[model samples]
Target chain A: MTDHAPKDIDTLIELLAKLPGLGPRSARRAVLHMIRKRSILLTPLADQMQRVAETARECLNCGNVGTADVCDICANEARGNGILCVVEDVADLWAMERAAVFKGRYHVLGGTLSALDAVGPEELRIPQLVDRVTSENVTEVILALNATIDGQTTAHYIADQLEGRVTLTSLAQGVPIGGELDYLDEGTITAALNARRQI
Target chain B: MTDHAPKDIDTLIELLAKLPGLGPRSARRAVLHMIRKRSILLTPLADQMQRVAETARECLNCGNVGTADVCDICANEARGNGILCVVEDVADLWAMERAAVFKGRYHVLGGTLSALDAVGPEELRIPQLVDRVTSENVTEVILALNATIDGQTTAHYIADQLEGRVTLTSLAQGVPIGGELDYLDEGTITAALNARRQI
Candidate 1:
């Protein structure tokens, strides 16, 4: 609530501060930079934000965000390889896509089941995922959940529910492609060693 | 250009990455957060950004960014205390305002004199600052430029230009208040000792 800038500008700063990884000080600096570069950066960003606000929506089938009811992957016939990749959130799905190795449709669970927070099977998209597996004729389900305790619990629950119905899999635990062994945590090092290849 | 998200969302991320302190990863996260909280955060932020984009402008008298030709500080008669504070940029002016100790109006020079970049006094608002000193009946001018080499050079040049007309003063150089001696650079320590005051 700085009196130095106009009210609208201060409001913009407040909103910007709410963004992840941006605090009040950085938000102020960002606002000042945008104000200075109004024509090139600020105006276009404002337009884009408005357009996204008006059009963006979650895909009804997969829980992925897009402007359409069905996300691009869910709508594309080419992506329906009878393999479904289940992720904890849209960010995880997007990360998998960035690797460009997985050539199949994805189901975003929105969140993992958290017993501590009273979150259960009904809280996430687990029911919808089960329905999709049977309806979409999915043959294999890949669980790409985070390697956290909650994520593991959720994965196990989903695997038990879908047992014998489809081939269930999870991402392998290993040393990252370019990771240095010295910098890796103890758990990762153990996993990499235990899963050591013949080569 | 990620093929995972829709075109508009990708565009939004790209534009957001151009903002200060935000990179591609943070921009993607921010876009996702905004889309997820469209009703509460995204829509209002877009509206505020658009408002500021349309209304915000630099004050003609002082180069301060506001929603009017003359900024609030420039328009305030009470702030016209016959002492003008000059800063190298709008951020510095805002910093001075944050301190809330300076009761006089500010003149933003836009940039300092950089010989390497061939930026001279004419490139800045030096001429306009001189005009304001005489037109506004100012008796003292405080040069609150940075302690950098270019900033010092600019301060000295301005002081020489307004030597006999009015009292010219530059911000004092010393160890910053509450600064640890071990963390301070040698130059600051030397300046603090040289300018030691009697109790």
Candidate 2:
């Protein structure tokens, strides 16, 4: 609520301010930049934002986000059969996708199980995953959860629930400690995917 | 468009894909992250985005973007005086503000006068600037143009137009060749501000 003309610039800054790493100050700076580059940056950015605001959606089955209901991986016929790579979130799913290895399908866990946060299987998409294993003819489940305690705990819980029903594996070591799939390079993600071992 | 469930993820991805530094792929990843962090990140981000999209605007006088029409800087009675710092764009104005050295007022030219691009005085709000100089009681004019050929040419033109009417000066010579003022650190900007010499 500034005492100004309040037009294009304010709309842009307000949008930018909601970004993960941006505050009011940074948002202000970013808005100014976009405005200055209106032809090359601002106009297109505005158009895209409007378009996306009207289009983006989540995959109901896999939790992967897309401009569709089921998402590409889930809908693709070429993806590996009955082998779902379980990920903590979509970033991990994207990391796996970027590798272009492991043509298998994916399952997004939404988040790790957290006792401190009182998270449980029901809180995540675990129940749906269990249903997918049986209904989709899934033969293997790769636990591509993050290496944090909560992530591990969630993985173990899922494994225990689905034990003996499907082959269980996890991404192999080489992922740096405290590493997030979002921060990993394509090559590293590929290597990790290729070398994935049974848990 | 993917072939999956709920269909909302599509809307989210389409919106996210439009963000800066994001493509369709990255947008999917980002949307997934937000969905996963729904309670923690997504809800708040969505709320903020919606709110901002509804309320942001620009300053009528200085062209500064804000939540209001006049903008905080222009509307402030404390900021008014006959000293106007003319900048090639809003980014330059922001950099000057970040340096926190100037206290008078600002005049955003929108862009420099570019001959190759066929940009002229009318396209850049130059006439409005001339109007402000006389109407606002401005004594000093700081030409904070970028260190580019077009920028310098525009600066010269403005200085020529205002010759004998006000004290005209340009930012000092430490600005790197072809470097954007936005890329420079706070210290460099501060030093540049401190060392600004007469044109």
Candidate 3:
């Protein structure tokens, strides 16, 4: 920004630059766009951010982000079909919800177990997940974790803890709905071939 | 976002998506990052945006954005070196300031003369610029507009109006600093060749 730019605008750009994908250049562009569209973008975005700051909270039972102690998913009774989907992060939980295919409640693990970073089950919501499995009418546990090593390690640990208590399942690994075989890696091709089914 | 997402959080994501270079997916990622770093990013960013919304205004003298009627460069007596650098927009003016090469104050044209868009001298700050050139101790005018058709047309218009009144110049054309000759376009190479000088 110019040295003559207002201190407030400079600070806004600085803060916006700290976001996930934005750096100084893109942040400046975004700020310029906002200032040009102040009524439509700047003021409304500020008001909305303030509202989220005041109201956003973590769900007490599932660790999902919402406004109340328990998230709407965790509070609803019809969605609980004795199946609890375990995810690695709130973003993943939200991604699952967007599909609108799953009718079961969710349990957010916050993160996967990582020995290099010194993260463990205690650091995640693994204990809360185990407690929910026992308290809720959960008959099956679906581990929808990523295919990363740490995600698989965490899944194996959870399975060991509830080996015989509930039925354990995981998301099927194969070619995605719109995926092409030419673009897929060997591991995916092998999985898809091994899991071949008849129509 | 999930159907169970808090209404305020959802609204925040929607508003953030309206920003330039950001879409729904990036907005969700940004919201997640802000919520994770609430104290360091979300609250402070919201507060700073509110402040900018209340204080930011276009300078009456030059159309630059600041917290006052007159921009800092326009008000600074030391910068009045009898040279006014004319630019097409506030962002262009800011880009010039960042280079720190020019010492004179600036005149933001707000926009270039565009017949297709129905923009003319009246729509821009052309009248104000003409008044400044006469009222101020301006001995020269630098047309630092972009190398586009609209920009050239605007420069020609300004030059015709202010001919013989002041020594007028435009930015030099050539390969950019650190630009490779192999990657430069033929037009740039031609311009550089035509304007070549002895070392």
Candidate 4:
């Protein structure tokens, strides 16, 4: 509480600076904006954050976030019909969901296998994905990972592990090279999904 | 629910699909990811959302977001230097703060004076800004508004109103065309701030 740091603003700036692609400068701007839109964006966002902090949990079965364990998707009996789409991250999964296509379960890998980061299959949920394939009677596995080198590598590894156990497909070529699923438009994603090919 | 949404997965999918940039395919994928990352990303994200939902609020004075009525910045006696930096949005203000350059105070003008949206000064905090400038002994008014036509227009209007009463300046070059200050790098922002010329 010295003259150097304003406590609350400092805490907020630190938190904001940790967000992906945000530096100190951007964090400050974001904080200021949230302050201005407090009634609209800031308040709502904070409320959502608090609610999420309190009640949100990861589905024990899948990696999706929800208000409860096993998540709504994993709890749903209708979605257990053997189709599982695997993604690199939650944002990617969310992107796929935005398309309003695909009627299947999901498995989030948390992140792709990065050689630079020393992320192997074990670091990811690859082992869990393999176990789920056998337990869920899955007929198809859609490798909907991103198009990055790491994403492709992770997808290939998953495909290898599930070889011959079930049908495997990946999203078609509408996704640009090095592009993340999170950045793609719904129409592009939809087109890619509709034209998916067997890997 | 019927076969159309016989499972919580479907319900979850419907909800997730409605998120920004997410579609049905991505929603299902995201839901799955959250389920798997229950203890990590999903749980934390949900909890954060909940927390933010409950505790977030606007700063009564500067329109910054915080748990209290007056944001941390607004309530701080040290930040009250009678020098108000006006910005189009909180994001811009946050950017300035991130640079840790300015120590005065802030006035977030929710948005620019947009003729297309029929937004006027009354619709924004322009009047509040003017009041703060006069009452706060503001030696200088930095118009850190965006580079957009509307942003510049708003800056010009404020400048004209203040006229000879205060030293007026705008963020200098290095800010890309139509670029929001929030998106600029810290060094670039610093350079721009250092090079700022009179408006």
Candidate 5:
């Protein structure tokens, strides 16, 4: 589908279509909406994007993205507890922060260990995590990885590396806070049953 | 939910959330993805947006947006077939262009006549359309407004103004091409039956 929209407008649509969850049709709609609301939406959005493009950077310490080199979390000395939460990516780190429960700092692994993709300990920030554990005197390491097979494999590997150096724990397997029993998978149900708690 | 992400990152997410089809959660996800793919996606997108913001403008003759005073469609003398398609907005004009069937120029009404909102003929491009019909030697005018009530009301108003000046037509309502009878709405089915052709 082709419209005689200006070359710049077409380029904008093409770039917008590359965003997650937006296809060509939605991208076109978004561009049209931006054009119609040029003073309010388009100009501001463009300015914000330009600012972000100039300033956004990954946190060297935890892989979290921010305008600064170390990110706000890594820079805040108050959040540096004796516990460190290990996560697969910055998104996971952000999710944990949203829960507002984990007060300690995080260590983003970049990605899990994937033998199929030739990803190993060195490919991730595993070495840096070990260095941090020793240097920061961390007493506990929480494995906050996903429940996927790759996630479990990576967790096991990290657990082996920090075996005697620090106490290791993982997020529990059970029904989610407001999840229904009938909707859960059998594996989750079995895991929850085996790890039942006393009332 | 709040994270210790940089203030700039948070502001970017907040602005992105204002876009259509995106909530705060999706905006956060999109920001994270853009940050991760900064070099390939984010930077290029920012550049394109800035370019469009600087150059994009509405055509003086028609209401279509382009980088020039007159839009490409309006400037193309070959497309000036004495047949003008009047649309409620630029998006409808774009949709017609995507179909690649229409060869005539377009006149964007900007919006329909809405008494509730106090919008009248002067508020839209009604006078400009009337002027164009005579000055451009337009012999036919297709009202390609939407099927909404406001759309039909506006179409009838335009038809009244240009009654004897040019032949007036509108998009036909029927079962869409490849549409199934079972999935069709009652109104559409009735319309299709009434407009049935001889086999």
Candidate 6:
């Protein structure tokens, strides 16, 4: 800052810069743009941010964020019929929801099992997930964790915990949609080939 | 959004998405990050934004944004002792101040001359700049606009208007600091060679 910059504007820039994918330069640009559009963007954005700060909370059962004590997904009985999608984070849960492919409820583990980080079954929402499976009468649980090593380890851990108790499945590994074979990695290509099926 | 997203959170995301260098995906991630860090970041940021929205205003003299009617650079009598740096926008003026090389005042033009956009001298702070040259005993004016076509055109227009009244200068065109010849374009290399001095 020039020291001539108002303290409030400078502070806003610093906090905004802390956000993911934004650095100091982009944050300054964002602040300038906000100052220029005070009514349409800045004031309303401030109001909304304050409102979210006051009300946003993690779902009691699934760890998903929402305004209520229980997230909409967990509260809706229609969504909790049978299948339960298990994910590594709320971000993954939102992504699955965005695709609109999954009709069942979700369980966010918060994080994966990591020995270095001292994260274990008790650290995540695993116990809550198990309770939900039995208490909510879930018939099938899909391990939709990421393809990372830690993610797979967590998936296996959950599978062991729920084995024989209910039907369990994992998302199929294959070439992604719109992916070109020429640009595909060897592991993905191999997986796609190994899991090839009749159309 | 899955419609499960709280209205305030979604509204905040939408407003944030309108900012430069952010899109829908990044905005979603930023909102999630903000919600996670509510006390330290989200609440404080909201407060600061509201403060800026209520207090920040453009300095009537130079078009520089500050919390007062006249910006610090314009109000300080010590900074008015001759040289004036003319910038295309408030961002450029702030950049100049951050460098701390200039010990004079600044005049923000608001924007450069644009034919298609029908922007003329009156649309910017050009008239006020000319008035300051005479009223404030300015001896020199530095056109610190960007190296864009409109910027240069605006610089030349201002130079013609203030010719013979005060010394007019433009930033030198050449390789930028830390720039390498191997990575430089031909035009910059040519400009550097043309402006080469005996070392």
- Using lDDT as the measure, the top candidate is 1
Candidate 2's C-alpha runs over 4 A off are A1-12, A21-26, A33-58, A66-80, A147-153, A172-199, B1-29, B33-80, B92-105, B112-123, B131-137, B144-157, B169-199
TM-score of each: 0.96, 0.63, 0.94, 0.55, 0.93, 0.97
Q: Considering DockQ, where higher is better, how would the candidates rank from best to worst?
A: 1, 6, 3, 5, 2, 4
Question: For model 4, how does the per-residue alpha-carbon lDDT over A9-58 read when each residue is reduced to its tens digit?
Answer: 55555654544445566555555555444466554554444444456556
* Order of candidate numbers by TM-score, starting with the best: 6, 1, 3, 5, 2, 4
Pick by DockQ: 3 or 5, better one: 3
| Per-model RMSD to reference | 1.6, 7.6, 1.9, 8.7, 2.1, 1.4
Q: Per-prediction fnat values?
A: 0.74, 0.13, 0.71, 0.13, 0.62, 0.68
Comparing 2 with 5 on DockQ, the higher-scoring candidate is 5
Query: Distance (Å) between predicted and true CA of B105, model 6?
Result: 0.7
Error of 2 at A159 (Å): 3.0
Model 6 misplaced stretches (Cα beyond 4 Å): A1-4, B1-4
lDDT of 6 at A113: 95
CAPRI tier for the interface of model 6: medium
Q: After aligning candidate 6 to the native by TM-score, how far in Å is the CA of A194 from where it should be?
A: 0.7
Candidate 3, A1-199: lDDT as tens digits = 3444678888898899999888887888898889888888899988888888888888999989998889999889998789999998888988998898999999888888988989988888888888888899789999999998889999999999889989999999999999999999999999999999999
Q: Where in model 5 is the C-alpha error above 4 Å?
A: B1-3
Q: What pairs collide in candidate 6? A: none
Interface RMSD of each: 1.2, 6.5, 1.6, 7.2, 1.6, 1.6
DockQ of each: 0.75, 0.18, 0.68, 0.15, 0.62, 0.71
Indicate the residue-level lDDT of A191 in model 3. Answer: 91
Q: What's the TM-score, to 2 decimals, of chain B in model 3?
A: 0.94
Candidate that would win on DockQ = 1
